[model samples]
Target chain A: MPLFDEKVKTQLVQLLSKLTNPITLHFFSQEIECPTCQTTHQFVEEIASLSDKISLHTYDLVKDSDIAKAFNIDKIPAIVVSDSKNTLKGVRFFGIPAGYEINSFIGACLEVSGAKEPLPQPIIDRIKKIAKPIHIQVFVTLT
Target chain B: MEITFNLPGLETIEQRTIPLDSSVIYDVIIIGGGPAALTAAVYCMRKGVKTGLITLDVGGQVAETSVVENYMGYNHIEGISLVQRFKEQVEQFEIGFLQGYKAIQLQDGTIKKVTCEDGNTYMAKAVIITTGKRWRRLNVPGESELTGKGVAYCAICDAPLFKDKDVMVVGGGNSAVEAAIDLAKLATSVTVVQLLPHLTADKVLQDELSKFNNVTIVYQHQLKAIHGTNSVEAVTLFDSRSQKERTLNVQGIFIEIGLVPNTELVKDVVALNHNGEIIIDCNCRTSRPGIFAAGDVTSVPYKQIIIAAGEGAKAALSACEYVLLKK
Candidate 1:
């Protein structure tokens, strides 16, 4: 029934089990002529079934324009994962995070869900060293 | 157009533009609009940091992709589709996306300043450079005229469409070899025309190519012209050593020669390697502070989709951490 096979879903579930906090996956999509939107939904749902901590929330970008406006979601198949505290930590995964980095995305979600920020000793020392709010502007070109 | 988000103690939010030399202060300003810029925007926005992105176009090279089978999720997807999805996600936040503008200059110190092409300027605490590279052209006649008709830069998107048809790959590098091997599996025949005397690809790919009978490797050859009407019909080659010319009957041409880093804007200001690649540390931090580079533009060894996205994520995370320290 799904484009992705059961084996992939099983693997996603296995990864979801290792997560320690609740991750709310907010999916913003449209209905018509939208195949990838459905596919993204299926992937999230498959992963959702693996853990109680993971929840799937859907918002129609066209129908629920207000909600879409709130999240600034203008396209379909956009996902936003937030921790239980309602603070947004992660971002929209453009296209799909498939292949090798999917595992790293899961890791980011787990880290964000835990909502723990431990500053490195060097960074803390650096922050203390600064007397004012320092602004750093970096310019990079594609090479 | 500016949209203001309501936050405590943020009473009067004004929409204004500043000149580059006016000494306006900013926390951070980013240039370019590809994966690196988008990821940086997300990270900075989440930290409740003020950030700005300046660029004329949004998607960069990723926008031209027809099918992204390797970037992840779904068996396949159009390149524009993925970029639109990314744009939608960025729309949710209050990140300043200065569209229709190009950054022309950069400066150092606590407050950095960047001048745009239109004479508008913005200052920031830090800057992240995510401008991706541009694929070099074959420079052969008809290659440009028949681009969409038969010439393509991506193998994954055009390979399937050429099933049972004859295809030609031009280049001596790993990308060309891998594409030829992949096309050999689908097309009727695959001919690799290289400018070098021999294959310059890794030994593993050269050995793998040896197993494919449908593939023919032509050394010391270069594409001189592409013949076609509405689509590609044939390709002309010139022998470098003998100075002789030959023609092959083919319908498609995949140019895998190489890519030129899109570093024109920042070349004079930043330190670049001999190949024009921006040299960065392990964390995607560029030679200059508040400036980070990622993806194919950097001196990273491997150039793959997974590696680019991983580098993009790292650059974003690092930008986020950098902003927190500034605050």
Candidate 2:
């Protein structure tokens, strides 16, 4: 059975039609030890099939340690979205991205494809003055 | 409680994007994602002012509600669904959204600066504060310790976790009564302990609650303490008139007394009323120049979603005028 119904798939297709650039979903999971890893892998695969602009690359966290370290993935069931040129846009989802977080995940994909910086000009100018590294981590729940 | 992944409306696969360019300075920064803030964003965008919204999440308090019957246009709509529609409308405009970020502090100056909890500081010419409010706690013994274990704040979020269990709601207001009615459908029984002689909720809500046979209302009783070992097992209530205390055994307790405005970020920057809500004029202008407030966080007469959205429009127009004057 399909995860998404036909109605939802049609809507998704229409939404994905707006994508200007190709996008890649890099999913990191372990075959064993992780419970939601397989489900996350399948979900991304199903979503990737909806748009020709979107593709999925699955990797084993234990076996492909080098690739996982390159992506700075510390946990299983992780997804990283990149642009057409395989350039990382700093979009990362730690968990399955199920529930209400699916909106966030799809939004990030669109953002990467559009490559439009939404920040206003003044904010960009102010951010340039920051001499030191400023790390920003936002905590969010699935609900 | 069973974790169901296929819950309807849980997975929203809508496609939307918020672009963030650190180099841009927004004309106005709205520090919330509720109805008021989203309305402000839409108005600001239409007025050709660059707007940015920083919030921990979209939907705010409305999303936490189960049903919204009072909001105009919709006879009855799920709170989350209403918020989703609001989000969709706002997405048509080009507004920057700093999603999943909480505003920790605010600095009022020529250019207002909002410091987020994630260490990012955003600058805006004008600021509209619509941070809204959160549920107020009982502050009694064991209430804080048993928060997630048994003491829940949102009935919509935790009601499913308490199937066939007995729960107690503490408040005399509409939210408490509504929560009792909502919980009564899922729980075996719901006991509402109000601190007043009569319910302060609207007559319509009172009437609806009266129809529920599983709900028990205790008037003129104050919550003394919550007693439990691992989770909430019972709550002691003191009858104000009789000068006697009684304990009722319940597995879960929902605190819906009222709400506390999220004005701590702007408390030092703007003038606040006795209730800690931001003091704003009819135009939604705050005491400080280049700053505005609307919605429940402000000294608004009503806290309804419609009123908040109207106040938000007013604040956005005022903010646009402020920006023009500065230029």
How high is each candidate's TM-score? 0.54, 0.70
The C-alpha stretches of model 2 lying farther than 4 A from their native spots are: A1-143, B1-23, B242-244
Candidate 1: tens digits of C-alpha lDDT, residues B1-327: 111211111111222322223354545566777766666666666667666777668877778665678876657767776776666666667666667666778766677778776566678777777777887897879988999888988786568778999999999898799889889999999999987778999999999999999998888888999999999998888989999988889999999987888788778767899989888889888877778777778888876555766776687678767867867
CAPRI quality of model 1? incorrect
Going through the candidates in order, state the TM-score of chain A alone for each one: 0.73, 0.86
lDDT of each residue in A1-143, candidate 2, tens digit only? 56666766676676677687999999998867456776777778888999999988888888999988888888888999998676888888887776666667777888899946355444566789999999997665444
TM-score of 2: 0.70
Lowest summed-lDDT stretch of 10 residues in model 1 chain B? B3-12
Error of 2 at B72 (Å): 3.8
DockQ for each numbered candidate: 0.02, 0.09
Predicted candidate 2 versus true structure: per-residue lDDT over B1-327, tens digit per residue: 111233223234443436544567889999999999999988998899888888888998999877899998999998998998888878776688777667898988999888886677888999999999998987999999999999998987888878899999999898888788889899999999988888999999999999989999998999899999999999899999989999899999999988999988988888999999999999899999999998999998878999999999999999999999999
Residue B121 deviation, candidate 1, in Å?
Answer: 3.8
